[model samples]
Target: MQTDKVLLEILNNRFSAIVNEMGYIVYRTGFTVFVKETQDYGVGLVAPTGELFAYPQEVGVANMLGMPMEDAIATIPEYRPGDVIITNDPYTTGGMCTHLPDIHLYKPFFYKGELICFLWDFIHSSDVGGLVPGSIAPSAYDIYQEGLIIPPRKLYREGKLDQELLDMILANCRIPEQNWGDLKALLAALNTGERRLTEVIERYGVETVKQGITDLLAYGEQSARAIIADIPDGTYTFSDYVEGDVTTQIPLRIKLALTVQGSDMYLDFTGTDPQIRAAFNVPTFGKTHHWLTVGLVTFLRTKNPSIPLNKGILRPVHTTVPSGTLLNPVPPASCGIRYATAIRVIDVTFGALSQAIDDVVPAAGAGQVAIVLISMPDYQSGGYKVSVLQPMQGGSGGRPVKDGIDGGDFSAGFLRNIPTEMLEADIPILVHKYMFPDDTLPAGQFRGGLGVDFRFQVFTPHCIVTARGMERHRFRPWGRKGGSAGTRALTKVNPGTEQEQNIGIIDILKLEPYDLVQIMTPCGGGYGDPLDRDPDKVLKDVEDEFITREAAESEYGVVIRNGRVDQAQTEALRHRLQTSRILKPFDYGSEREEYEWLWPPEVQD
Candidate 1:
């Protein structure tokens, strides 16, 4: 007989607490800045069959749901009760750890000599011995250059740490002590999950606990199906582009054609660009994978905050990924910086769904990671030191209901910029300005938020600043339903100087004493018609220096006189704009026309 619904939900809620408690122990005992402050980690409980049973909803990384443990478990059949398996291989882990920087650990939970569940955890280590200190670079061409890829092995056997394996890992990375601290903390976190999970089994009986996993997964499946069933059944296609290849100026195209029939959805990625030589390939293994649906997942997680975390939540969705494309690349394709392409995947998905849900979808966003890497050479140390100088990002696209968040990281939500003080203390860099751009927001009924304009000057003579995945230079973030496109991003060296350079995309330059690096991050696109916007809001933008008076007159059809909007002139201008008989659709720019041609239905498949 099945248990009561209330009891099942209560146990599920308690199971969530157990995982959260597990995540906290890692943060409390971990030693690295990544785990302690930045908190780039995750924890969860797995059924004996390797399906996810319980996950931390509020905390922990949300993207680890696709990780596969059955293969790893098969690779090592014999395991004691306290034995723990460790791996960082992207292919071996079944896309669990997307890259080598994220080290994954799993411990078997046994009840009377039979394995009942698996306690799983992962943390992005500070460094693994590679061409770069952080084990990630746009320049790296393959997985080999990224770092060491550990196969599934016992990190701990019978509750005792494997000294040889630990030594091998510590010796390969630059920060041994910090890595060890993080590893120990992970083990401790798993132990917490183990203790609480065993207690659950003891109280409810193993059979009931096993049945709870099935109940929770089925609940999530029902919720997801209900959401998809509301959308009209039809085929919708959309496409977007990455800024460019790191080694080339040609923009990489990513296409998506979504078909929603009944409660099922399918995403086809046949016309996407061939994989590049650089590090921008997604390693999803081509399921309704996490990389392809992070935006929708975030939306669902936010809306249904209490939904259970399991594979069934994603059962309503499926994907068709072509080999050698940016979404699913063949071997030797560098994948260290795959998140750049991941952003385009999300944007394309939204583009496909716009036809079905105009109000639910907004416009395009700054679809690139504003990554900046800085390195300093110390003569006394005799080696180069590296640090991420503000993992900065721009705003998201404005929604139909409201404006996007200003100076926000889109896909990697909850990840923040490293503090200026931390950068100054750890690395040799001076931060002069870190604030929102003065007049970067796009104009509409709902204006897109502005991006951060960070100014930094190098103090060290032998320092270098390199960056990748910047967009909105040649093409702007496009708006929808008569809204205006957002302003483009700019990267320049020493404004007003005759020798200043306007860098478009992907550059590695040496820094001098007086050299400055200024990044004007991209703004999000607006929603609805600008002519329909409030006159007072347009006046405020002009007065507050968010947009120029000329911009209001030209784009929004609102006239300003003596620091205020002229009501009579604005009314006349709005009328003129409405009757202008413009031939251009709202998405009129390089971003739309190019992708439209590249991903036509005939060319697909």
Candidate 2:
């Protein structure tokens, strides 16, 4: 506590409030539902050195806390009051704009003729004009097909909107008006940040405000270091694979060797598969980017729930994502589906860390977040309407002491599912079912959370459906310490109909009138052995229809008869099953077990 602890706490709260209010303004004023409801946006204040110094804890995208601004800011010739720079080029921005669909805006905050800080924010535009309607397709071969790539440019000059530039950008997009409104909303948020920062300066004076920013960052760094020092120092290695690339059925491997020494951690992704032709590459620019370090960030947060959300937390994290690898791909490699690779990165990081501190980490979660988009012709307007059906996700992994959360993943836990009413009102679709399925969770002492089954029918003819980030079809979420693996994902078209089709995993699909689409995401991996589970819990699960009597008996060795647990029979069954069961440290599903047997880790290394 180099700075006054009381003052640092006060300043931290005030700065966080400023960014949260900025996010609120954008959420209320933005045009698209993605921004207004789903909140696919972020707002923060950056230091002159480019790292975020202040960020909202409870607003916008939760994982975008460490986006760098120095490279993008350097591209600007000079900054004046009210000048805003905009860019969506991932390569040019040094990974600040991760994907083209994410349009980033930065405004320099000036006070007393000096640049004190910067307001940085961005929103995921609904449509940015590309090969697909939503500007993102898992099959995109390169960056050219993803969407518009805007290099760092002066979007606003000298407190005035660059109308020509803005109009040019809008004209190239499918939803011109919506994009324009979202951009305006971003500007409003930046203005809010500017005003609030100015007020803080006026009240506390510029020197104190600057000192406060420095002190807060230092505090965050100290807190992160303390947490990291607690972990046992050692090198741990782990590897995971993407089921397949969009262009080919060959699985892509992601490898990591994490070394922890004192309070410093180094992540090496040397043996990972090279960048594929599809849009799954992550452009990290070989820096310690957010995607490469989010797992460590999550770990720090879990260790210290009161840790500040800033770039200081990443101070001790060092990374080596070799160029041409999936984690650090070269230019021309499509990055529209980078999140697909990022999810695996999170899982692999967890896998490596779990070896060091097994009890602190949970088993593998349902490691995918899919956004279903529907586009069809609007007869009244004679134009197409694009709307997000839902940002669907699966369940988190079972923890050491408790069950996983149902229908939610820990990686993007902040994102909210679209309500059925909202979907029906905006899109021409009928929601028939949206609920958790029974018998899908992995059986364990602390059972995994249940996955979701969403069934809907499209009323509009010739509607196009695209689901991005669909994963875990072949490989199930792995369980640890004798727990069972979770279920696999599935997709169906016209299920239970005469013309039924099994669309196992898809990037884009076409639908006719009355066509039903059902998406069933995977459940999370369980923790501990099923036989170790309490008989009472198994009885409750059966009564609630979460598990069938057969599942309760077979999976957990619990004997249930006529809705009541037979205690003596349950004890006998548990004893018999435990004697026959063979436990393993990691329970990867059969698919992975067979795949690994063919392509062993030693061979890959």
Candidate 3:
């Protein structure tokens, strides 16, 4: 029996590899830049119980894993040999779609009439039919403006494409051709899942294959439990805020409380803010859903990349995101930019977990960074051209073990900025400057990483630039323990010039020729005491141009004279600075944080 269990675990990992390969195929073959470059998609193999048994490592959006495949299966009961169910519905599919832009598809696999598994994939389509080009707006207030809400329906009936549904979807979006290409790519990925699954069943009998899933989840549960157990069991709570709902101009709060007992951990989110009418609400259907857990999973991945991606990882943990809250919004509550709040939730979770397991968790990171879309009519092509003038992101705060990585990737691990050459080729724009912003990173023993700065000149006569979910502007990512706070975000036109205006939380910007657009991202928070930093490291940073001599004297109390460290002067300054500085907990966005005014941290705890 034990041998069978071990074999099942091994087979589970093998099948997981197959799904990962399938994910890569979808990414490589997809047409959209969002799919090809940013990799904003997910691939999973659902078990007989309708839960995901295997998910992709490269794919980072893990919250949608529990989205009920059973509801989708029942919606199209006429499941023949080859049929795929596709939908992006928030209500009918049980919060699977959450918003209209994401296109989701699933197909069941069978062996001798016995249903074995379901293949699932979803991608954030560039555009969907709506009042706005992106298929989301805070002002819209209703589902009608949010674009097409696809309920669970058969996209392929008996291996043949459903032409009517395809036509309807294509007619609604601005980029139909590109969307169709992505759909075909996803279909190919699902085919890969089917092929790989067939081999698993053949190699280790169908019964064993099913049992392997259960055992793998068990193993993950054990591993996650062990990780949780190491932290001294206690209840730690924290809360954070987003700028506001674009429509109401009211700030939103996300609350969390972490409870640990032995190997079991529970995340309670009870005092969170009420769900807004805006598109920023999180649609996590309660439980230890992916939105709140993926960051922890990302951190866990750094330690154990071999752990299986199954519901079992959630076994040692649980969540309580309330309905109509920021973490769990209701229908027609615009969730188009929901990931913004999700990133903060991840940050707060780390904040709370840091209390129990300081070494395992990391300091605050640049929350969520985004590039706005600017569009205009191209005279040469007589077509609308889109421009991503700048790819924005915040610096990663220094970790307990090491210095933070500069200009790090967002929540989606695979997200990478498009090269200047590619951006220029795709749009009518000239790249002026793209480099790390100086004097922005927080300084400490292990200095925080610096954020990016990008400046562009619009060549077009008229262009529309829209930005949403740009946080860390009013407040910065806070460090933990003795670390320091990070720098805030900023955006403007010719920042140092006379026309400079603080363009914060922009809905849209109309641009004219020779308009210089500048975006400065948030810097990472510094960890540990600055005085403890090695003088050699500070000198090196000065040489690397990551830090300035003025910063070394002011922030680190390190005095440098004639390009050399003045040991006696530095020692006296460090001693005085260390004694004078107050040893207080790092301030995240708390001064801007409203506790009872919105949601309580324990609400989601």
Residue by residue across 256-319, what tens digits does model 1's lDDT show? 8889999888888888888887778887777667788876666556557666777667768888
| Model 3 regions more than 4 Å off | 1-6, 59-74, 378-383, 386-391, 589-605
Quote each prediction's TM-score: 0.92, 0.98, 0.93
Identify the runs in model 1 with alpha carbons over 4 angstroms from their true place. Answer: 302-305, 378-384, 466-468, 507-509, 561-564, 581-588, 591-605
Supply the global lDDT for candidate 3.
Answer: 0.75
Report lDDT per candidate: 0.76, 0.87, 0.75
Two-way TM-score contest, 1 vs 2, winner: 2
Give the alpha carbon lDDT tens digit for every residue of 555-598 in model 2.
99999888788999999999999899798778998999999899
How would the candidate models be sorted by lDDT, starting from the highest?
A: 2, 1, 3
Instruction: Please give the TM-score that candidate 2 achieves against the real structure.
Output: 0.98
User: What range of 10 consecutive residues in model 2 has the weakest lDDT sum?
Assistant: 242-251
